[model samples]
Structures are given as structure tokens and as C-alpha cells.
Target: MEEFTIINENNEFKKGKVISVFNISNSNREIVLFSSEDFDSENANLQIAYLNIDADGYNYISQIDDEKVLKEAMYIVKDMIEVINNG
Candidate 1:
């Protein structure tokens, strides 16, 4: 699996697998990343990320309409990956 190098605001680094990349159009794109199995199936939109992860057995950070949340989540995930890499 291809891994992504993520750096958080606290100078943390993390590695995540790229689950899937959705191409809305030629110029628009989105991806989903998952670090664990904790996923919800009820909400379609919310689970879009998880579905991509589960369907492909990979992880990826998404680029969706909500840039703020994606950035925050990416920060946290990067921090967590740093901890795992360090230890």
C-alpha cells in the first residue's frame, strides 16, 4: 500500500495508506483515510470516508468541501501517527 507522510501543527509526523480517491470532475477530487476500524454505517455522507477505507482496505485523508474539518482531522491523525512511529 502507498503511504502518506502527514505533518501536524505540533510537529508530529504520521503515515497513512491511501484508501481511495474520488474524482467528482476533472478539477474536483476527494479522498478518505482511516487509521482504525471504528466506523459508522448509518450516515452515508459521514461514512463516505470510512466506506472508501473499508472497500479498498486502505486509508487516506480526504479533500472535501469542508476544508477546515479535514485539516483538523489530518492534524490529529498526523500527531497520532507520530506517536506510533516514535514508539
Candidate 2:
């Protein structure tokens, strides 16, 4: 459970733990999902973020190529967080 320091658009800094890092099949790109304690406007407990990675470096924000991919990541993170909380 590695943690990272994130700086937001307001220049606010937050500390979060890494939940998972994964790559889609047949793709060289890497995506990292992390959890922060800060809640969004909706007040979601687990604030999940994905970093877009390329050959050059990481992009500030990431876009989902497919809706299924976003859904899959949500499921994966949910399961992982469950294990961490209940196990």
C-alpha cells in the first residue's frame, strides 16, 4: 500500500494510498488508481483517480477509452477495498 502526494487545481495537497496499477490487454499504456481521503462535491468516501501513462510520461488527467474499462476499474477497486476493509 504505497502512498502518493497529490496537488489539486487549487494548489491543495493531499495524501492518498495506491489502490492498483493495471494495463489493458494488448496495450502498452499503464494506468494507476489511487484513493484519497478528500471527498468530492458528491461526498464520495473513496475518491478514486487514474493517471494516464504513455511512453513519454504521465498525463495530468486520463480519459477512458471505453465505458467498460471504467466500469471494470470501478469493480476492481471496489473489490480490492472490500478486502482491505474486511479482511
Candidate 3:
């Protein structure tokens, strides 16, 4: 699976693999990241949303919500994989 990561506005760590990606009914793209550790279902949903923002090629949206820290950290770690792939 592919991987990518991003630092949340609050500066936390999130790590996960790109389990899958697909478009919703509206054609909006969505990405999923499965956390490397255990977390509640709510946290999982937040992580999905946060990482989506990070991976959508909008690298300049400042100030992600505080609840998204774990998700962000996961994405940032996954992003390291992307860096490695490119290099």
C-alpha cells in the first residue's frame, strides 16, 4: 500500500498505511489511513478526514482542528514513505 504523512496544526504524530482510496457518490476523492495503534471509532473517522486534507495537494491550509492531531501525525508518518518513494 502507498503511504503519506502530514503535521497537523496542533503538532501531533499520526502513523498509518494507505489502506485504500476511492471516490464518494459526489465524485469527491477520499483517502483512508489505518492507524498503527489502537484508537476509538471516532478517532478513526477524524484521522480519515484529517489525512484527506493533508493528501489532497492543498499543502497550505493552516490551523487544522485540535481533534485532528492524531490523524495528522499518522499522515505525516505515512508521508515519509512518499518521500522515500520519490527519492
Candidate 4:
């Protein structure tokens, strides 16, 4: 898994290991799942972050707060699981 650094709105920094990546169909956007003690010491939750990948392969991280986007992401992940299991 790749490592990632997160800079919150308060200018605080956190480090974590990337769990997985999912590309949204027909879009340049992707969601990366990662985990860090900075989020929760017990690691009770899985956190997700979004980014936009440009044509040149550059990516810019952007926080996602929209419910519809999140629901779509969840469905994408579910579909991925189905593919893996059926394979």
C-alpha cells in the first residue's frame, strides 16, 4: 500500500497507509481509502479521501462532503467486491 499525507483545514498534518484506490467510471476523479492513528487510535473507522487525476497523471487531493458522491463511491466499491468474489 502507498503512503499518504493529509493536511486538514486547520493546517494540521497526518500520515497513513493507503488501503485501496477506486476509479469512478467516466470521470477523472478517484477515491482513495486510507487509515491512520491520527484519525482514531483504536482504528474503528475507515476513512476515504478523493482526488482528481489530470491528463498528465497528476493528482490533487480534495475533501468530499457530498452525500450523493459518497453513495456512488460505495456502490462502486461494492461492484468491485462482486467482481473479485465472482472471479
Give the distance in Å from residue 58's predicted Cα in candidate 4 to where it truly belongs: 4.0
Q: Which candidate is the best by lDDT?
A: 4
Ranking by lDDT: 4, 2, 1, 3
Candidate maximizing TM-score: 4
Q: How much lDDT does candidate 4 score?
A: 0.69
Q: Cα RMSD to native, each candidate?
A: 14.4, 5.3, 12.5, 4.1
lDDT of 2 by residue, 18-74 (tens): 656766664455556766555354331345444664678645445567667677767
What's model 2's lDDT at 10?
Answer: 86
lDDT for every model?
0.45, 0.62, 0.44, 0.69
Model 4 lDDT, residue 45, Cα:
36
lDDT of each residue in 1-87, candidate 1, tens digit only: 554455545665544445433433323334455332212332211222322354676644543456665565466556656888998
| TM-score versus the correct structure, for each prediction | 0.32, 0.47, 0.33, 0.54
- TM-score ranking from best candidate downward: 4, 2, 3, 1
lDDT of 2: 0.62
lDDT of 4 by residue, 1-87 (tens): 266676666786667676788777644677986665465455433666796667898765667787777788877777776898998
Candidate 1, residue 17: Cα displacement in angstroms equals 1.0
- Which TM-score value belongs to model 4? 0.54
CA error at residue 70 for candidate 2, angstroms = 0.5
Q: Which pairs of residues clash in candidate 2, taking residues 3 or more apart in a chain or in different chains?
A: none
